[model samples]
Structure formats: structure tokens, C-alpha cells
Target: MTRELDLVVVGSLNVDLTAAVRRHPQPGETVSATALSTSAGGKGANQAVAAARLGARTALVGRVGADAHGEDLLTALRADGVETAHTLRDESESTGTALISVASSGENSIIVSAAANARLSPDDIARARPLLASARVVSVVLEVPVETVCAAARAALESGARLALNLSPVVDLPAEVLAAADPLIVNEHEAREILQRNGSQLPDGEVAHAEALRAIGARSAVVTFGARGSAVAEPGRAERVPGVPTEAVDTTGAGDAFAAAVAWRLSRGDSLPEAARWATRVGARSVQHPGAQPSYPTLQQVLDEPGLPV
Candidate 1:
């Protein structure tokens, strides 16, 4: 019998190669980088690690290549206390990789090589059925194949687990999967793009974008504005959750931290607004440091941070 878990993440795992540059170059231009770093990352892995460190019993369902990067990613996930029994190894492809460039202003741009991640099929979701059944919340990110994401959504629905869909790098998805999102999470740009993709009138403001998502198909929705907070919309209510003011040293994994925190808190029975509030703080804290998984703050860390005011 699989034990109950707070969250199960069905997404991609990648090794992130990051470069620090003074500024991002314009197209056809190149800039010299000051430093380079390699880290255990990928939207799925980062969210799973953040959830685990925040005291949730989290499990990851994804595929990694049979390579050194894969080994390192698995080691990092385990060290962070995320269950990886379902993280499979594929021998055909190298691990997924993200080439990221962070500028002095703390903004970043990334290019992804979806190698092994592209190999995660619906069959993988079928194999992880039991783990999905034992989860209170199933969080799905879009770094993997869309078919696999759809399969995970169906499994979450069948298991009666709440679905938290983070629509980053947004793409067209079936309506049923869109409707399954208990709280569809998106950044400001993603929100607008998703709305536009669905043939809805483009919302003029960020808060309206959140409301429009709920109107389309999502049970509820959240549109995040970095450093300014997020807007949340549920069945009958809409609210803005303010952001935590902090100096950002790197903004890389802040959204992943936010998504993880919201999913974890929702599993603990927080309301949409309540969860978004917690997520905002977690995201704010993440940008204060460098890297993705490494920058996440534990629940106690959030509670103890001075001037956060809870």
C-alpha cells in the first residue's frame, strides 16, 4: 500500500547550467559572463524539493536520462527529502538541460533542451497511478510532453486529488485538463497568453487576467506578478495577495517555489487566497539568493525570517 503524500509532482527534471552576465544581450549580440554554475533544477524537481523542504511529503513522477546529470539530480531530490520511487531512467536520451543567463538586475532568460523530458509518456503516468492515488494534491508542470501532462491530470481526477497546474511555457491543452485545475497557476505573461489562446478577450490588467482564467475553465486561478504579488480568483471571490519586498540576487526559481508552497498549503486545506499569500512570501524569499532548489526556504525559515510579518 502506498502511503499518503501531501503532493505529487508530475513534470520534468533537468540539470540547469547558469551564467551570470552584466546584462542580457540583444539578438545577434553576445555578452561576456562573469561566472558559471551547474545546479539540480527543472520545474518539477524544484517544486518537489521546495515542497519537501517546506515539510510536505512530496513525490516526483518524471524521467531522467541514464547519465551523470541524472544521478546528481536524483541525489539532490533525495537529499531534499522528496520521494523519487517513480522517477524513471531512460537510456536513449541524455538528461534534459536548461541554459540560463541571469543578469545583474536579477532577471533571467532560459533556453531548454527537452531531451529525456520529451520521452516521458502517458505510460509513465499509468505506472505511477498508485502514487497519484495517495496524494492530497497533484501538481503538474508543462516541461514534459503535453500528453503525459494530460494523463497525469486524468489520473489526479480519478484519484480525487486536487490538481494544481502551473502553466509555464504555456501551450494549448485540452479543455478537460484546463477545467481540472483547482487552482491554475500562471505568471502574468502566461495568464495573458493562455487567455488569448482560448479565444477569450485579452484582459487589460493582471488581476482581470486571473479572473478571466476562472471564467474560461479552471475551477480557480492565480496570476502572479513578481515582487508586486499575485491575484487570485475562485468561484465567488477574487483577491490580491501582496508580495514580500526583498532584494533579489537571482530570480530563477521563485515561481517554482511559489507553486510548491501553494500546492503544499492547499493540501493542508488553505483557501486559494490563503495559499497564494503564503506562496508570495516563499517566492519573495527565493529571489534573495541564487539558484532554484537551493534558494527555497523551509516553513520554519519563513516563520523566523525577520520583517516578513508572517
Candidate 2:
């Protein structure tokens, strides 16, 4: 069948509970939050919404609990123009949730309860074969089981689509898994994790970190460096994409938005450097707002920004 989606995301979905605090409390101390709110989030959901808002035909394949949160998440994705028909509802578990606390400095601490997200099986991925076959690019995150991620990646490769994997949560993923991805995105910390796991220490700098990532199996690696911008590395070259000058209000989903924009651009046949530029713009846009999915920008919003090549 012809591709039905420009991008397909397979991973977790969560209800995010956010609080703004003056500062993070020290050990054994407590602090009061200044504001609180709830929104739909999860790396998978956020990226799917990000791609859809940026004009990609997107589909999400994952599981959520048969609860109000799940219903709300599905509705939100649909409203964002993402296809959720492949999303399954599990009655045995509640929807996943993340408790996020943001400090005045725009730094955040988060605790996630995987809930239904952790229960996703390879069967769920198998059920999404058609959708995977119909996508030009398939993205997966670490929130789901490794087997599920691998299955999705392998399927996408077999179907002649690109496989993009986000090595989030900074865990020790199997080497085979890394080898399967066409392009893998990770933050600076995650790059350190992979190097540490391989019995190596990355030098304390973006340039060094980018070099180490290429030493690993990623055909290409994109490392997001927060305020310092981001670095992109292919087999023979690496370059830093300058970040937009913006005062961040919340940094929670900035990386996810960046990854989504990069994947969207790649699906549209943009080169890695071009995609990284788009991702930087998207990341900058995300921090200007406060929440995860709520903070993502539409294609028009990104295009409206000055100096962006569109």
C-alpha cells in the first residue's frame, strides 16, 4: 500500500501534571508550588502532535488506559490532526502520568508512572504493521519495551521507511537496537550514558560529545544541548546548529518538539543540517510556552518566525 502517513510514532502517552515552583527543595526540605495545571503529554504523544501541527500526516500507535485521561488524550491528538485509530485502550491499567515541577530558572524535575505505557506489547506493534507499512518514517522512544521498539524499527526498515529512535530516559539500550536506527536523537546527558555504558567517558563539551555519538552505531546523531543549541553528526562530519536567542519559561518538552520537527523535515526530504535548523526553531518555540503538547507550534507559527527558511 502507498504510504498513508508522513510519520508514525510508537511509544507512550501520558497525562502531565505540572507545577511551577520558585526553586527545587533540598533533600528533606519541602517547597510550595506557585501554580499548577494539567495537560496531555508523553514523548510519543508530544512528538506526534508536533509533527501533525507542522503539516505532516501523523499516526500514533500505543496504549492508554480506559480512563478519562485516556479519552482526553485521544481527543487532544485527534484535535491536533493526528490519527489515533491505531491507539488501543487497555482496561487493566490507568493511563500513564508525569508529575513535573519547573523552577524559576526553567529547569525541571519529573517523575513518570508508566502505567498503561509500560504494558505495551509486541502484539501492539504487530497490530500496527499496516500503519508502519504506510508511513515514510517511524519513530519510537524508550518509554515502551525494547522489544516493541525493536519490532517497530525492524518493521519500518523492512517496509523501506526510515527508522528514527529517540534514546530518552538515558538507559542502556541494546547495541543491536542502536544499529537499526537510521538516525538517532539524544540529548547531551544521554550521549554520556551511552558512552559510559560502552566503558568510555565523553569529554566535557558539545564537540567531544558529538564525536562520541558517531563512534557509537548511530548512522547519524543529533544532540540537543539546551541553551547552548544542538549538534548534528553523520558518518564523516558534525556541526552545531545555533540556538534561537530566547528566555526559556519551561524546558519540559523542548527536546521532544525538537526531535519531532527534525523527523518531520527528514520525512519531507530535508538534509540533516536543514532538519536540525527546523528542530532548533521548534525547540525555541516550545520553551516560550509553559506546557508540553500545549507549547508546540503549528507550521504557520514556525514559518512566521523571522530568519527561518521554512
Candidate 3:
């Protein structure tokens, strides 16, 4: 019997400590915050939560420390109905954390302390092999060791699952691994970094960037253009999908939310552009609230969104 999981996110886990500020502090200057809060975050955990909330059978494969913070993170994942069987607790390091500053304009800056997340070794990936193999889409990010991500991509390919790789934090990847990705997901800036680093001229626009990304390796590519929407590119095709309007309070996990939506929809057999359309709506929904997981919408909510295509 083949066990089927919609998505399995393998990457970092972090506890986000965020502060509300009128504006970001200058390099040598200090700024006062209006409020502060703590939330469960991490590329892996956030993506899995977004998929699970949208009615996907999702799981998280990653590491957290055996601290109280880790316990809270585990609780939060379980609360979101994400399978945590593959999530491990490392007693050696403390839980990962991110220091975040949210500006009034909905933009945010973050500093991450990888802590236990950095300790997600190849062995951890070996242990999660079964879960990875069972998933229809294996979502990977660069928060953990790059080697682990490459290994997961290999596993996804071997298991006949699609690899949805998000090259955030903009690290160089081996061409083989890049080629294995079914859809390489990146924001406009990350796409530029990847393209320019490979001696390819940066594209002038979102759809062009997506096309450039596919040229390097990925079977398809999606480049996010913030509130303007996203562009999808594959062999001989590139198109734009406009973004949905929403009252955005925080943009913290918008990208992760978009990735999650894309992964879930792709796992269910939607085409890349269709998946990105749904992802745009999900990303828009994510910004309407204050935190990452807190802002995620349920499948019904997205389905009921105004102006959804019939």
C-alpha cells in the first residue's frame, strides 16, 4: 500500500520574537517599538501549517531543541494538524529563533539564530526518508544545511515525488539538484541572485526572471513579484497572474504561505500557473493578519475569496 501525503516540508524551525515599530532602526540609531509578540515560525513549520490548514495532509520533517520552546513548537504543529512524527528533538542545541521587526507599511526584517535548526544533519534526513518518500510534494528551503536540502531533493526524485525547492536566503546550489526541482520557487530578489550568480544577466521583470530560472535547471519556475503577483515560466511559456488585494498588516510569512499553497495545489495535480494563482490568493490572505501561521487561511476561506476564478 502506498501512503500518500500532500506535502512534506523539510527545513528549519524557529521561534519568532517580533516587535512592532513605526520604522526600522537605522544602522547606528535606535527606534522604539509599539508592541512585541512571540510566535511559532520557521520555513519548514510555516509551510507545513499552511498546507495543513488548506486541507492538505501535510507533515514536517526537521529538528528542534529539547527545550520548552521546542515543546511549544511541537504543540503548535500538532495544533495545526500537521504530522510531526518525523520532527526530531535535539538535546544538544537550543531551539532556533528569529528576531523580527515589523514596520507600519507591512514590510519586515528578520535575523535568524539557527541554533538547533543548523544541527539538522544528513542523519536527520535519513531518518525522515520514509515520510519524504510518501509525500506527493517535498518542499525544501535553505534554512537548514544545504546538504540536507540537496539530499531531500534526491529522495523526492527517487521516490517519484515532485521537489518544490525554495532557494531563500539565496545560496548557490549544485546544477544537478537545481535540475531535479519540478518547480523552483523564489521571490524576485532571490531569482536575481540565482541568475546573476550563474553569469546570467538579471531579467528586467518577473516573468523574465521565471524564464531565466527554468533555463538554468528547474523544469518550471515561479517568481514572486510581491503584491503585484507572480510569474510562471516553463519551456516556451511565461505568464503573469495578478495579485489579489487585501489589507496587509504583516508580510512576514507571505512567501512561505505562497510556497505552501503552490506545493499543495501541485500535489493535487494543478498546473503551475493554476497553483500560483491559488498561491497568490493565499499569500494575500496571509498578509491580512499579524503573524505567519495566524494569518493562514483555510481552504474554504480561499475558495470563498472574492474574485476567485470559476
Candidate 4:
């Protein structure tokens, strides 16, 4: 029998082409970039790497194209100790790519061409059913088809695995899938957009936003507020956790690190708030470097950094 996985990530994998700019281009405007770099990325792949770096036995379930970029992504994941047994390759489409522009302020804007990621289907999830069943936590992201994410959630639920849904680039998810999310993670903007889409009243504060999300469907909710830390809400409780202070060099992929950390900690039986606290610290560490996967801190790096909690 296959050893149970600590975390299973069902999502997208992409090669990130990043450019450093003085500022983001205005609408329909062109700008010169100072430098350009290439790295492995994709929400699914990033989460798997982040969790593995943090000492979780993680696996990835997604698709890449039959190309060099796809091979590079697989290499990066394997280097980080993530199992890629379920990561497939499609010949019809090119590998997914993300065009990222990082401004001098460390904030970034990204445009993704999903390519083979778009080909991931419910069948992919079904093929990975055994891996999902053996995971303590299964994380799903929205970079792929929503139906595929829903299928992963259902499989996780049926297998009694905790579901951690990172609802970035938010979309309308079914109530059942939302409910399965032990903690549905989203940034402040995403949290508001979700409420707006559901035709619900906007909450006045971040903590309120988390509570509103829990009220909507998620078993719990987390509203990340960048450097301010995150707001966490669960049954009969809601609170904010402050971020660890760090000099951010690049903000890209920090959110993926946060989501991965939360799921990994949850698999270890940490309470939702405690997990979010640790996740916040991990996120802070990621910003101290450049790129997505390259910037993620290992467990030692995170623990070595000056922080209240280990």
C-alpha cells in the first residue's frame, strides 16, 4: 500500500516568466523592464513544494504540457521533495505560463495562460482517488477548471480528508464544495468579491469578512490581509493574527505559501487559528526573497527567523 500523504494538491502547474519593472504599465501602456527571469510556479505546484519544504509528505495532481517548461516544473517539484506521480502531461496544448511584473514596491501583477492546466478534468481527480484518500489534507485551487476543483473536494470529503480550498481569482463555487472546505482561504479582495457575487452584504472589517465567509458555507474561513496578517473564523470564534515583520523583496507566491502552511499544520492537528498564525509567518518569510517557488522557506529557515512561535 502507498504511504499516506500529508497533503495532496490538485491544481495547476506553470512556468513563470517574471520581469522587474519600475511600476506596472497603465491600461494599454507599455513599460521597460529592468530584468527578466524564469522560474517554476503554478498554484498547485507551489503549494505542494511549500508543504514539502515545510516537512509535509506532499503530492501534486495537475497537468503540464509535453515540453521543456513542463519538465522544468517537474524538476523543481521533485527537488523540493513533492511527489509528482499524479502530475500529468498533455500533448495537445503547451505548458501553462504566467507572465508576472514585479514593481519596485515588491507588489506584482500576473497574467496566466493556463494552457494544459485547462485540460485538467474531473477524470484527473478520479485517477488520483487513491492518493486523495490516503492524504490527511487535500488542497484545491481555482487556477484549473472549477469542476475539477469541485471533484477533488468531493473525493477528499468522501475519503474523510480535510479540505483546504484556496479561492484565489475567485469564482462561483457550489455550496457543497464550499462547505467541504475546512478553511476556505482568500485574500481580502477575493473575500469581498465572493460576498459581492453571492449578493451578500459586505462586512466592514477583515474579521467580519471571515465570519461572513463561514456563515456562507465554509466550515471555517481565513481572510489574508498581506502584512497586517490574517483574520480567522471558525465555529463560535473569530480573531486576527498579526504578521511577522520582514523586508519584502518580492511578494509573489506568498499567498500560496500561506495556504500550504495552513493545510500542512492542520494535517498535524493544529487548530485553525494556530495554523493561520504559522502560515502568516511562512508567508512573511517568502517575501524576503524573489520568485515563487524559489522564495519559499524551508522549515529550518522559517524556524530560524526571529518569530514568537516556532
Candidate number achieving the greatest lDDT relative to the actual structure: 4
User: Candidate 4's residue-wise lDDT over 262-293, tens digit each?
Assistant: 99999998999999989998999999899999
The reply for model 4, stretches above 4 Å from the true place, is 1-3
**lDDT tens digits by residue: candidate 1, 116-224:** 9999999989999999999999999999999999999999999999999998889999999999999999999898799788889877776788899999999999999
Candidate 2 clashes: the total is 0
RMSD of 1: 1.4
**lDDT of the candidates, in the order given:** 0.92, 0.88, 0.91, 0.93
Cα lDDT tens digits for candidate 2, 41-72:
99999999999999999999998999999999
Candidate 3 wrongly placed segments (more than 4 Å): 1-3
Q: What does each candidate score in C-alpha RMSD?
A: 1.4, 1.3, 1.0, 1.2
Model 1: CA > 4 A from native: 1-3, 307-310
Error of 4 at 158 (Å): 0.3
TM-score of 3: 0.98
Name every residue pair that clashes in candidate 2: none
For candidate 4, list the clashing residue pairs, or say none: none
Q: Name the TM-score of candidate 4.
A: 0.98
